[model samples]
Target: MHFVIERNRFVHDVQNVAKAVSSRTTIPILTGMKLVATNEGVTLTGSDSDISIETFIPVEEGDLQLVDIKQEGSIVLQARFFAEIVKKLPGEQIEISVLDQLSATIRSGASVFTLNGLDPEEYPRLPQLEEDLMFKLPQDMLKNIIRQTVFAVSTQETRPVLTGVNLEIENGELICTATDSRRLAMRTSTVERNDQELSFKNVVIPGKSLTELSRILEENDELIEIVVTENQILFKLGHTMFFSRLLDGKYPVTSSMIPTQSKTSFSVQTKSLLQTLERALLLSDGKNNVVTLKTLPDQQIEITSVSPEIGKVTEDLTTSEQEGEEMRISFNGKIVIDALKVIDSEKVNIMFTGAMSAFVLRPTDHKHYLHLFSPVRTY
Candidate 1:
């Protein structure tokens, strides 16, 4: 196998594919990246069993040439070393050639290095799913959905299903939900499906996978194609393809858990509330990170936090609007700050059923996304 590729383009594709390669992979060959050169273009792939990413660089894009193929073949190279070498090479182009006995030579500018290559045949094959169930979403919108929910997924592995984000599609609407039992985040969006009759439920994707995918996705209006099956999900972004294995257990039913009505409701400036909670948390117990919110007269609310070793903090914030019964609620201030940071609107609406029940937070102008937080019992 021999080929010469533009240095910058090759570096970009390598870094993207390297996101899937893990050094702790049980399979020895899985740590290496597979590169295949064909008549059309050059393909790079990396995987660690649970997730796989493949990207292609065409021989030429319009008038600019990307890759020149001397011989059409394939090779697997150590991902860690190869990526570093390519990035630091002082050259406009890199030339790679595989020699006898699975040895490869890399040359650029005045630098030359030889790396022992693994046989590409030993690499695991990526799943191939029929495009029977496929839909499209704007790249920027998909990134927003991931950012809004993936953080709320449970880190504990005890309940494997809760460590993933649940995706459900029905009647042209797609809902994504994630929860750690203590808090939950949900987002809803309309999808363009290839089949109008297609619908699915309980398709839980690992939170880690979505986090990585978000990093690679550029914020733009380009549409990304999504294909879902029983056990795997594929995200097609132009010439790149990302694949992830679905969780095996059933996701807990969460619709009944969200409160339909609130006993106390108020709208407040999102930034002001976030900053107040951050300052209050500084004086609270680090372990609990609790902050107390008490409704006052004249549409004002009091925020306070106290610690035995430290002192106390109190501040009054005037709400834009307040209604229902006056109440006091204590919750983890860190969780509220996280939810507030993701909200895009200037003001946020917070609704509480009671002091002991879960409260909901959402943007004042949007009904498609919301965050629910379970209150803490403070003495």
Candidate 2:
């Protein structure tokens, strides 16, 4: 295989798929990136069993000429050294050629290096789903869903289902939820689904996969195509495609966990309360980083946090308008921060029945997302 590619263009595509490559793997070939140069363009693929990312660089895009292929073949080059060498090479273009024994020579400017590559056949084949259960949404929405909910997933491996976000698509509504028993983040979006396709349920996607997907997605003029199969999920973003393995077990039913009524509610400024807690967090211990919120009349909340030896801090946060039963609730400040970041509005409504039950918080203007945090068991 032989090809000439712009140095910067090659480096960009390499970094896109490098996120999928595994550093610690029993299969040595999985550590390298698979490069396929055909008549169409140059394709780079990286995989590590759970996720695979493929990006193609066309010969010409708009006014930029990316790659020119002389021979049609594929080769796998060591990802660790190849990425570094190409990035530091001083040149406007890079020339790459592979020999019969899978050895590659890369030349640019006055520097040239020979690196051993593996046969592309050794790389694992990516999953191809024939099902048409697909949906279309702006790249930003998909990226937001992953960032908001994936952080709440369980880090423990024992309950594998909790480590993934449960997704269900039905009647044009796509709901994503994640929980680790302590708190939960739920985002419901009205996504455009295929009119002739059937709806599905219990599609648990690993939180780790969504985290990587968020990195690949940017806030741009691009729409991402989502296709789900029985055991794999595919994301098509222009000339790039991403695949992730689905979880095998059933995700817990999270809807029943949300309460039907709240005994007390407070609609306050998200930034004011968030800033109050940020200062209070300084005195909180790593084990029990608890913050107390006391709702008062006239749209005010007294926020306080205390530690055994560190000290204590308190603040009175004012809001636009507050009307609900007054209550005092203690919760993990970290979970509150996570929930606040997801809300995209100026004011967030906080609702709770008591200190022992689940509490609900959501943005006032944006009601599509609800962030619920279970109150910490405080003495």
Candidate 3:
């Protein structure tokens, strides 16, 4: 392969795909990135089984000449070295050419270097999903959905299904749920599809994939086309393509866990309550990191936490509105922080169900997202 490209453009494209590379990959060759030179442009691919990301840089991007191709070929370069070399190149232009079938040369400005590369044929092929079952979501909405739910996925591999976020499509609405038994995060968003469009259910996406997708997105409002199949899901954002392998087994029926009515629901300032808990968590660190909530009459609430060895901490938090009976609840400080970080509202509704049951937290502005936390007993 031979091509002359701009240093910055090359660096940006390489870095984007490199996000999929894993340092602990079982396959040695999978650690490298595949570089394919075609008549239209240069394509770069990186994968680590669970997720694969591909980026394309066309020769002519509108008026700019991004790549000039002299020969058409493909090769796999060490991702660690390739990324560093492209990013730190001294000049505006870069010339890359493959020699002796397994060696590659990259030159820019006053620097020239040659490195050993592997045959692209050794790389695994990306799985393809048909466009039959595809839907579109606003980039901002997709990013929000992933952020709101991915945090709740279990980090431990005790249950395979718990490490994935469950996705269900019905009636032009997409519902995403993530849980680890201790806490649950669910986010729903409307799609831009008509009744004629196809719908799917029980799609499981690994939490790691969703986290990488969130990072890859540049916080845009552009509509993204999502294509799904039995084994794989693809997210097409203009010229780039993101692919993730679906997890096996049925996701738990999370709808049944949500309560239609609550014993107590009150609106509390999101920032104020978050700040109060942040302070209380310091004292509760050694005491199971538990925070006690006492909801009183007249829109007043007391937040307290105590530890036998450490000093106690208490804070009075103000609320916007209160409903139902006054009740007290206790929650894990870590779980509360996880849910509160994603609640993007000025105020939030906290529901106290029972001493042994999970409590629901909802955003006051949007009814699309719900955070449930299983309280820890510290009495």
Candidate 4:
């Protein structure tokens, strides 16, 4: 197999695919990247069981030439070394030739390196799913949904379901929810489903996978195709494809967890509240990351935090409007700040169910986004 590719374009594709290659993978061959050169283009793929990413560089995109293939073949090369070498190649083009015995020789200008390549036949095949169940949404919208919920996913692996974000589609609306038992984040958006009767339940995706996928995706208005299967989800972004395995267990029913009534409801400036929480957290220790919110009768709220080693912080901010009963509640300062960051509106509505129940935070303009935080017991 022999091919010549533009150095910069190849480097970009390699970097994107490398996100799926894990250095700690138990399967040695999975650590390398599979490269297939055909008449159309060259395809690069990487997989680490949980996630797989494939990107193709066409021979010519419109008027620009990207790759030229002399022989049609496939080979797997060491991901880490090959990526580094491609980035530092001397010229504008890279020439790679695979000889007998699975040996690869790469040349660019005066630089030459020989790498032992593996037969691509040994690599695991990616799942091929029927396109019957598919949804289309702008790439930026999908990324925003991930950002609003991924932070609340459980980090502990004891409950595998909580470590992933639950995704469900019904009535042409897509809902995404994430929870760690202490805090929950939920976001809903309308989607254009290809089939009116197409719906899915218990489609839980790992938070880590979504986080990495978001990082690799560019913020653009381009449409992205999402294909869902029983065990895998595929994301098609132009010439790149991303695949993630769905978590096996049933996600907890989170709708019932939302409070139906609240004793106190008020609207406050989001920036002010977030700034107050950030300053208050400075005095909180790692284990005791608690912050207190006291509602004063003067249409103001007091935020405070105390630490034995550090000091105490107290800040007061006037609320936009306060109603119902006045109350005081304690919660994780870090979690509150995380929830606040995703809110896009200037004012946020805070609903509290007395001092002992979980409180809800949501944007005043956008009612579809909700964040709930469980109160922390402070003696």
Consecutive 10-residue window with the lowest summed lDDT within model 2: 190-199
Off by over 4 Å in 2: 62-64
**Cα lDDT of all candidates, in order?**
0.94, 0.87, 0.87, 0.92
Error of 2 at 107 (Å): 1.0
lDDT of 1 by residue, 195-290 (tens): 999799999999999998998999897999999998999999999999999999999999999999989999999999999999998886678899
| TM-score of decoy 4 | 0.97
lDDT of 4: 0.92
Candidate 4's C-alpha runs over 4 A off are none
Taking the tens digit of each residue's C-alpha lDDT, what string does model 3 give over 1-379?
8999977878988998999999789898888999999999999999998899999999998899999999999999888888988898898999999986688999999999898998899899998676788888989889989988999999998789889999988888899999999999988888976445667888999999999998878787899999889889999998789999999988989888987777877888888888888899886655478888987667888988888777898888778667777777777887888789888898898887776678899998978989888888766
Q: Which pairs in model 3 have colliding backbones?
A: none
Q: Tell me how candidate 2 scores on lDDT.
A: 0.87
lDDT of 4 by residue, 169-237 (tens): 999999999999999999999998768987888999999899989988778989999999989999999
Flag regions of model 3 displaced more than 4 Å. 194-197
Query: Per-residue lDDT tens digits of candidate 2, residues 202-261?
Result: 999999998988888998747888898989999999999999999989888889988879
User: How many residue pairs clash (N, CA or C atoms closer than 3 angstroms) in each of the candidate models, in the order given?
Assistant: 0, 0, 0, 0
Which prediction has the highest lDDT against the true structure?
Answer: 1
